[model samples]
Target: MPRAKRFYIPGCVWHITHRCHKKEFLLKFARDRNRWLDLLFRAKQKYGLEVLNYIVTSNHIHLLVSDNGNRDTIPKSMQLIAGQTAQEYNIRKKRRGAYWEDRYHATAIQVDTHLASCLIYIDMNMVRTGVVSHPSEWRWSGYNEIQNPKKRYAILNYRRLMELLGCESLDALKEVHGQWIEDSLKKGKPAREKKWSRGIAVGSREYIENIQTKLGVKAIHRKIHESKDSSELREDQSPYTAIFGTENERLRQENTYRWGLF
Candidate 1:
């Protein structure tokens, strides 16, 4: 079956997720996590990848970045980071085979509330998994860096993030970010699982439809019936329900290489 072409709209913020092969704890140790972060730093230097937020969990990773309208930058950065991380990990562990389960899932995020929601989602991933009580407790995530500017890690581009969030100063951005995260926690809004990881793009209805039109794909229809499973859809008003068709359906019907994620 042909793969779906990845949508790379310039100036869009993307939430990317990639899991370890077989969902194994490939990055179980702190050193391995640091290694991945090192490679990400290198990718930033080499390709100018504007990383906004990130969290390196034991089995998977989530990254928020702005494409700046460059189609090749994200793919190239991912290739370099994932390829080097896997190669070094294999050499050290004396293991061989696929390290990543599949190509990373990239979902375009609207610049408004959706971006903020996605950031909170990524930040609170560890908390949702019972790994930490708060996102600040996770050392490998952007929460600590954003909350404490003296972390001395140049992973997140604070100025750019603030710009995107429409904040004139770092202090203002941090205030709003902290308040939002606190409110979400108090309301128990952090999802145990995210539908953003499963969809093509997430934003306002108009924004998603525009992307569909630009990609020359059929518009996604809302699910007529909701499933009872927790892993299924939720009542969130966000336009995250618009999936870019299933991979098998795309392969059979479009016969094109632009298949969505597995």
Candidate 2:
């Protein structure tokens, strides 16, 4: 298959996914996962990457970030993290070949309910796979970091997060976030959503169309898909964009910044 082309758009949030080479479970161990997170922290320090949410799983990684309108931030940070990770792991194991499946897949996300939904979806990943019953059970995730914030080396932009969620305080955000999780769990086993991993952009009609316009040639052939709740722009033949919904209380938060996405 041809390498997936990256579409760059400034001032947006992005959901990034990268998998281990041939799904070998390279990060199946805690130490490797921790190393990836450590490199992620350093990438934050070195590049000012505004990480919103993340999860380092056995064979893949999910990162939710608010681009700072600096085009190089995302790619550069990825290079540092992925490159160093692969190099270190290979040297440690005395192995060779690719550590990553390819490069990665990035989906632009609309802020507000869509963004919030994406956050919960990411945290629920392990739960969906039955690795754990709840997101808190998994240590390598932003959800854990948020509920139990670290005094040092913390990730996630709390203030910006609050602004995005239309909340006034961390306590409120936490309460609302937990409620969202609880509400989600009550819905039973969550199935994987393709929009986050496959779509070029996910949001409302206007938002996706706007992204498509901005993407110009790259998105020329892609099409927008509309369902009852939301709209998405996706390729002709694959998992594409999506629409979403949350009942009453979950629909409260209605909204990121000059975030560049890759």
Q: Model 2: runs farther than 4 Å from truth?
A: 236-262
Which residue pairs collide in model 2, if any?
11-259, 67-259, 112-255, 164-255, 230-243
Instruction: Mark the 10 consecutive residues where model 1 has the least summed lDDT.
Output: 225-234
Question: On residues 1-262, what C-alpha lDDT tens digit does candidate 1 reach at each position?
Answer: 3333454555678889999999999999999999999988888888889999999999999999997555677888899989999999999989999999878988777788878988999999998988888899899988877887644658888888999999888788889999988988897646664556876667766666555555443333422122232111112233432445465334323222332232
TM-score of each: 0.82, 0.88
lDDT of 1 at 237: 38
